[model samples]
Target: MSTTQSDRLRGLLEPLVDAKGLDLEDIELSRAGRRRMLRIVVDSDEGLDLDLCAELSREISDKLDETDVMGEDEYQLEVSSPGADRPLKEHRHYVRAVGRLVKFQLAEGGDLVARIVDVDDEGLDLEVPGVKGRKPTARRIAFTEIAKARVEIEFNRKDKKEEEA
Candidate 1:
């Protein structure tokens, strides 16, 4: 869709989203067969639940119906959270991932899979897992050093408290 339409939609929806204590992360309008699909991704620091998604969807639908923002085209609206494995782009994304395993593609070199121990405005403290029974080593990486990063799902993870005990 056109940038003007996207910007208009953003302007129209952002306030509604903010009023509900969430951020509108993204919006996409795409053609699906004869109908258009408008997907809205929303999130909050407290995270999203099914009830919130349903509520937001109803609110957004009502606003759109009143605004004439999408012309007269028939469209489907889907509202949801950014699922696991979304890219870590903003500082808040990293902050939310502080206790999770992440795969970082370094600007200077290769990939590193590390558990995030901490995050600050400048960089992150990661615990690089050791091979075999060796102790994990701590590594500091500046945000500038990262080209790409995403949270990695761990199935057989051990709790930090259990490990300490």
Candidate 2:
């Protein structure tokens, strides 16, 4: 999307999202075969639910219908949360991913898989899991060192509560 269009869309839709207590993570307007597709990714510190997304979709759709920003074209408006696999681009994204396992692609070279323990404006404090019964190690990674990163999904990991039970 062009910068003007993207900025216009953010300007138009951000307030609506803010009013509903959600952060506007991203907006993408693209072609989907015959029709245009508008994907709005929203998030909150408290996370999101399906019901909230459905409501936001309705509100955004109404706002688009009232404006000429989309030029009256029939486009599909999709409102949803960012998926776990989505790359962490913003500082807020990293903050939100604290306590979650993340796989990082280092700007210098190789990859690192660690759990985010803390975050600061400069970088992250990560707990690198142990190998061969050794204890986990603490490491700090500057934002500049992260070429790319995403939260890693752990299906079999047990939570503290589950472990206690």
Best candidate, lDDT-wise? Answer: 2
Tens-digit per-residue lDDT, 102-125, candidate 1:
999999889999999999989999
- Which residue pairs of candidate 2 clash? none
Badly placed stretches (over 4 Å) of model 1 are 1-3, 158-165
Per-model TM values vs. the true structure = 0.90, 0.91
Score each candidate by Cα lDDT: 0.92, 0.93
Please give the lDDT score at residue 164 for candidate 1.
Answer: 92
Candidate 1 residue pairs in backbone clash: none
Winner by TM-score: 2
> Residue 72: error of model 2 in Å?
2.8
At residue 14, give the lDDT of candidate 2: 98
With candidate 2 superimposed using the best TM-score fit, by how many Å does residue 37's alpha carbon deviate from the native? 0.8
Question: Per-residue error at 128 for model 1, in Å?
Answer: 0.7
Candidate 2 per-residue lDDT over residues 110-158, each given as its tens digit: 9999999999999999999999999999999999999999999988767
